[model samples]
Target: MRLLRLPEVMYLTALSRSNLYRKIQAGTFPAAARTGSNSVAWVEEEVLAWIQARIDERGLPDTP
Candidate 1:
């Protein structure tokens, strides 16, 4: 139940901030949750699921 910050999301997805935002805006990525007046975070599971979806798109088998 962790909330991942931007850097962590970027690292895990191998995406730059700009591209990440673009995806978000295009409704292709999970939206961030507002954590505070000036902060936001993404649900870890959602991000992981998104990654898994990408792998699934490639018809790849699950790997450890």
Candidate 2:
């Protein structure tokens, strides 16, 4: 149930700040939880699962 900050998430996912926001808006990535009036973070497990999903996607056929 750990929360990962932006920088950590960025490093783990290898996504730039804008790219992460874009994926969130496009519903292709996990959403962040609001932690305060001016802060937000993602769940560590969710991010890790997302990474695992990516790995699981290896060798799968690509959509046209």
Highest lDDT scorer: 1
lDDT of 2 at 35: 99
Where is model 1 poorest over a 10-residue stretch in terms of lDDT?
54-63
Query: Could you give candidate 2's per-residue lDDT for residues 1-64 as a string of tens digits?
Result: 8999999999999999999999999998999999999999999999999998898779777668
* Candidate 2 segments whose C-alpha is farther than 4 A from its true place: 60-64
Return the top candidate by TM-score: 1
* Each model's total of backbone clashes: 0, 0
Lowest summed lDDT window (length 10), candidate 2: 55-64
Give each model a TM-score. 0.92, 0.89
lDDT of model number 1: 0.98
Q: Write the per-residue lDDT of candidate 1 for residues 1-64, one digit (tens) a residue.
A: 9999999999999999999999999999999999999999999999999998998899767789
